[model samples]
Target: MSDRHFSHEVWLSKLRDHLTEERYAARTSRQCIAVARHFLRCLDKQKVDVSTAQPASVEAYLQQTRRMYRRRHGHPTDYKGWQCLHTNGIHMLLRLVQGLWPPAPKAVTPVEILQSEMRGEYAQWMAGQRGLAPGTVSHRCCEAGRLLDWLGERATREELATLTHLDVDGYLKYRAAAVGRRSLKDVTTKIRSFLRWLYMTERTSRDLSSTVIAPMLYAFESIPSALRSGDVEKILAATRQDCTQKGIRDYAILMLISKYGIRSGEIATLRLDDVDWRQEVIRIRHSKTGAISYLPLLPEVGEAVLKYLQDSRPKTSFREIFIRACAPYRPFRCGSSLYRLVRHRLEAANVITTGKRGPHAFRHARAVSMLRATVSVKDIGDLLGHRAADSTLVYLKLATEDLRAVALEIPTGVKA
Candidate 1:
């Protein structure tokens, strides 16, 4: 980017083209170009050459923009959405010209810097030494980060030697108030792992891990959540009707979940090459059991995904099939992002269910549908990638109505 390009109108044409590719409305594009023109005029008056302008100078111009416009620009639909759009429009231009839009990360304190370094080390140890899966490592690291955050200034390695059992108990007690019993138990487990690592590395004077105990758990305590027979269809129908970019991507995702009962992580991690158009099948790698299954590509699903890939998906170099529908386009951040997407779609479609409500709900729902269709238990196990036959049996617990049909009549001689 020549400084002259910024000062000149050469990049304005490029900015307009970029906005059009991103699906910006004609009105919004005009507003953006107008803002860019105004900005260049201001820079000219200030005797600041546009070609050689500093980022700080551009930031100053953006800062003064707030003074020119009022809070409510009288937009009826979005209610203050214009303010955000204006900022975003100008940012788009800056990103187009400079490429490094944000410039740099926010400054961090010494304690914070050390905290991040230790977390990275812990993640590496979990993956390299323990050979844990990526998902397990990520979850454990997040829990450990929580403990370190609670410790605040005392989180550094040298301070580990100064820690005591009271700190462990206090942290657990603090966490207990916010999470369910199962989550608290997981937190305790996460803490013990971190403490053990510290002791093994000789950072801690003693094994404080022995002091951390897990909470009790009951067997078969809660029912697994699932959507009704029609709920999944409702969500799919609603999403399928939406031809927007995000809708197209989300519809493809819902198709995978509903049709094959694959886990969200599998969908998020699915690469473009995973789909075999000639073979008419999609490859699914189980996120939990690490098993791989090839499912036949139903025409409906293949068509939906094909439409998204061709029409709406942003042009990105990511091998992942599903990309986010916004600027700074990227793949979903893993299962949790997909979970949020599914949950929102479920809620928006006015579908409700009790118990666990993430992508697992869709998986369980698929299982129930299979059961209702008289799918053999072995077939269910095979489709869902369950290593243990007993795992497939768990879904039978949710088929209360189907089970009732198979109940044998009790003999009169038998006692209640």
Candidate 2:
């Protein structure tokens, strides 16, 4: 707070360089610098502390700008454009100051500091002692922190000796009101794990994990979202007919999942060198399990991919085979991007699929197809990069016809 004065020239110069580096147009850069300079000058005139300036000041300035615009141009159709420039300029300066949208940081208390330390220690235990994946550890640690935050002082190591099942019950009930049955199951499991860890570490007197009851959810209660082979055919056919760059790319992507059962994550992270054309095989590096599996580059999938690479794929130096068709072209960010692409393709093709509509729907469809083909469970599991038998068994829920064929009729003597 001591250095309350903002040197307008110094900050404006920095903002100018930043805007130029970000490729903002010359006029836009000037507008942005002008707004930032105006904000700094306002702070000096009002003797506002730079560290503690309120966001309300930004809104006040914007309101003043709006009035000035009306007086100068009388609410022209394009006045909204100027308004956006003002908003962006103010936000840019604020973000540069705090490294966030908010002007001030929340003052951390002793209890908050303790809570953070506890979460970090728990994360270390989960990662080191349990060998959980990074994503799993982060999620469990976050869930534990949520409980600590909800209980406040009561959740401290010194105070947790008095903790009981009542607190766990209340927390579960509170969370159940917000999330669905399926997501609530994950919450309950994560909360239970935290409670068990706390008791084992001697932070809590009682192990209240068992009391954190989840909602009623039967194992494999719902079948996997499997688009029928015919529906998959329809989607691919629709994309093939379009014959655009995007359509070719979509067809190639669809073939990978529908024919080979490739996971979205694997597709996103697949590198250019992973594909061996001479060997007629593609290497899959699994992130979740750290297992690498090589799959045959089937003629159909390979041909589609070749067409995309030769014609439709962006000319980026990125090693990934697929790239975003738009500017700032880059490989797909993650599995979610793949999900959106598949969903859009499905909707565009007017293919109304059951259960999951994302790329995984085709994966499930492929699994069911293999099962029906009398392919060994081992082969199906290998193709899907499944790490456990239970993971592969989930798709059996979708193999209704096969299940019916193998059904053992109920004995007449055992019937009620």
Candidate 3:
């Protein structure tokens, strides 16, 4: 291939023909041809062989072209300058010579390193010993892997043995700046847990878990970001407009979360067998609490699920109730997809969501409604599959209507 050579005229002709075949506009084809000729001329002036030209050589030519324009105009080149055109044209020209251009490098992630170097040993430990859910294990391992990478820098895992509280502090501070308060809390908890595990297994020499102190939270440091009942209605109405198969699946998921307060992961893990049509009950397996609970299947929710199963849900060997609504039909690969589905529906309905815009908004809304209806904390906890009774306390702060009842009154002429 390197032995092959073409004259400047022949090269431009070939580029012109290729661009023409690609259905480029006549003006675009002319511009590309002009740029290609100028690029070849630049290479000739630099005494670089066109067949052996590297990407750097092409970039160098573009820089030189930019300098010439700047020198002539006595100003820096703008984005719409000739250098940008030459850059695009050179790429188009390089396609004719397959080996002239190199492929972009792939990025290596910390999670990939953890999987490859350690075979996710920590993840397995967390799952097996701590009885954590698979999702939790993945999240913990990812955060731990990132912390190790940040501490190690160019060094390897051998640095884990020498990890100090200072290193933990630096990493947590960096994470806090990048994430919000709630997310930072999760980061602090995961990292501290990771360090404790490392010490227990003799992976690290010191236990730095006690040193990692995140912000303390009262009962309701953050408000429950529940969607208003009107917004929920709008979202449901929007789903009715999308008459596609995907629309049906989304509506079913929305109903399950909004009506039953089921978590996204629970919706993903739902199976056909879990829905007892005769008994009119839907069984939910809560990964967070490791509990199985049954809730009454509402008529609307049941109908939506049935319609989705009959229309949108693909026929696959997977037993999961919900499958991808698109081609290569399979069960949802991640629980986050369910959250994104809710977000898309809300956006379509023109509902302006402010904070924590995910499927959990519906969960919070359900709890708030239950509280407004004078439901007991224990009943709300059971409804939402809360493992601890204390988990229900957060909803108490979200009962604005009840709080309004206990407000102190002021006399009409009490102003001093």
Candidate 4:
């Protein structure tokens, strides 16, 4: 492509589209593109082709520009402050240019390369054979990669098979210090499962899965972080007050979690077709349990969703109901985005919180509310889409009213 094709007007338009696809806000994109345009003009004057532009050339240009500005101002302020502006603009411009003429893949470390290969194979096996969800497979693959990194990068397949209790013990010790108890449990589980797979596939001579002991977890050990009904109301009210496109979308999401007790992943995966307006029900496809169920779409929730879809939702071919509220208008890459949305709203509403900060808090609150209303445990389980009653048992810890009712009364002024 001719360097002239990367002129001021053409480059800015392309950069705008690229930023839109990346989900940047319009104002921010324009500002970045303006800076990028200036940088490109400088390059054009220097008879430099952007495609062949190196980082050193960009850095040198940035330094020269700073010196000129510094000379005019004679100010002792940090130069890095404005230098960052050029750096960011150059980064965005180069990124756009590089995409058109893609660069060669960066060289990978031996350990990373080996881990990548193992992770790919393990992910395929988990998905195809075990019928694991993509999220689960991805997490397990990450753990497997971490384990391989712990083992030497140069270790051979034969050496891997020779892993003993001592190696496993050391890995667990190092991991435990690095993570919380819950995270440690997950690491141990993934390690054990990976070792089992290796042995079953004949990569190992001995079964080492049995050697990795998991941390024992007691039932109802942790307190359920259920928000008070008033706090839940506060969060909903905060969303309602914003009256912005993003607020509308957030209101609809909060309504789903609070009313139906659905998981964040379920909300992220929900599509336009999932809501049956004629039947006034919403179908949930649970990612964890892989179960499909429907619930009555409460009028408030329905209205919130309808308002968002009709007004705030972007025009897109994507079937998913929730998309990033900015351009290029794509669905969320992961469920964590939903958690951040809830956290932001919670902070805005000044709601007191502890432990969990995600949509699961709303799920717990839903269960506790149901229990207070004397709803059957089985019905609460059904509402939460719990495949087993045991899964619903955790909410019992938060059933303070029920516990208060069963407590023995003490005589007035009596001391223990």
* Stretches > 4 Å off in candidate 2: 1-107, 129-131, 152-159, 200-202, 215-219, 243-245, 404-416
lDDT of 1 by residue, 30-112 (tens): 88888877777767767886545566766677656655554444323342675565556566666777776756443299878
How would you order the candidates by TM-score, starting with the best? 4, 2, 1, 3
Predictions ranked by lDDT, top down? 4, 2, 1, 3
User: What are the TM-scores, per candidate, against the unseen true structure?
Assistant: 0.74, 0.77, 0.66, 0.80
lDDT of 2 by residue, 2-113 (tens): 3433355656677777776665678878888888777776777677744456787777777776777779887743656767877788787777766778643343888888
Per-residue CA lDDT of candidate 4, range 87-164, in tens?
765787787777632354342876566557777788899999999888789898888877777886534576877878
TM-score of candidate 1 relative to the true fold: 0.74
lDDT of candidate model 3 versus the reference: 0.80
Best-performing candidate as measured by TM-score: 4
The total of clashing pairs for model 3 equals 0
User: CA RMSD for every model?
Assistant: 5.2, 5.2, 9.5, 4.6
- Which candidate model has the greater TM-score, 1 or 3? 1
Better TM-score candidate (2, 3):
2
Model 4 scores what on Cα lDDT? 0.84
Worst 10 residues of 3 by lDDT: 98-107
lDDT at residue 234 of model 4 (Cα atoms): 93
Error of 1 at 262 (Å): 1.3
Instruction: Candidate 2: give its CA RMSD in angstroms.
Output: 5.2
